[model samples]
Target: MESNQLPLRDIHLPEAIDWWPPALGWWLLAILIPLSIALMVWLYKRITRQTAIKAARKLLLQIKQDQQCDNSQKLKDLSALIRRVAISATTRNKCAGLTGQQWLEFLDQSVKGAPFTLGIGQLLANAPYQKSPPNEQDINQLTRLCEDWLNAQTKRKK
Candidate 1:
């Protein structure tokens, strides 16, 4: 065969295509999926903080109604409810491992100084197993402060 008459072969080049999928990457998806889930959880907790506080309020109301029950128990329950809700609403790292005045300060900081002032914080801190139960007025104040904190948290999220 003459050099000019040599058989021609079709050369196939890689198709021009986008390397990235329209959908995001597995790594991005992995990060994003967890982030989205975390965001959802945070949002859920923010919205429901009020409900938890409300439940606590109801418990307090019941405690008030039950004159026979130990006041200390009621106080302890109230404190536990608030702590649980606080832990749920914010990162455990922020609220956990906090005790005594430090825990009260944590609550104060977490709520951004709404209604939970140093006094309220102190009350909550000193509440555990106290022989003297928190009176109706004290419980009312605590409930109000918790509701305020929940409201403040919700507002911050929005």
Candidate 2:
């Protein structure tokens, strides 16, 4: 057989090509950097929300302890603390402007009824400006209710 007609034909092969561009690293960085930033932001918000709830729990305990005393100031503080935590958990627009029965209802709706029932909500609604301070038992109950509400929120988040 002729050399050209043999089984081993004269086939030409091209040089190896580098199709991968250098900018691939930059493109990957662009996507991963923003993703990392977004993850950090989400983590920060979650941690802050948990911290706010912990602070609220401490404030509720203080209020309960002061129940045997005059507790007018403590009740005011408790009201403010709850409002702050609620706002943090949700948003200012959702919770900030609420007051009176509206505020109570807001709390009840947010917590999913683990703690802030209609009766407790009513009691808390009138709490801040009440002429008579709550007794020790009332304070204890309020504290337990507040803790329950916070726990419910935590569970819901989970």
Q: Could you tell me how far off, in angstroms, the CA of residue 151 lies in candidate 2 after the best superposition?
A: 1.3
**lDDT at position 65, candidate 1:** 72
RMSD in Å for all candidates: 5.8, 6.9
Shift of residue 44 alpha carbon in model 1, Å: 6.6
C-alpha TM-scores of all predictions: 0.57, 0.73
Instruction: Estimate the overall C-alpha local distance difference test score of candidate 1.
Output: 0.68
Q: Give the alpha carbon lDDT tens digit for every residue of 17-122 in model 2.
A: 6766647787899899999999998999899889888888877777766635455565566677778888888867988998777788777875655345465545
Instruction: Per model, state how many residue pairs clash.
Output: 0, 0
Backbone clash total, candidate 2:
0
Best by TM-score: 2
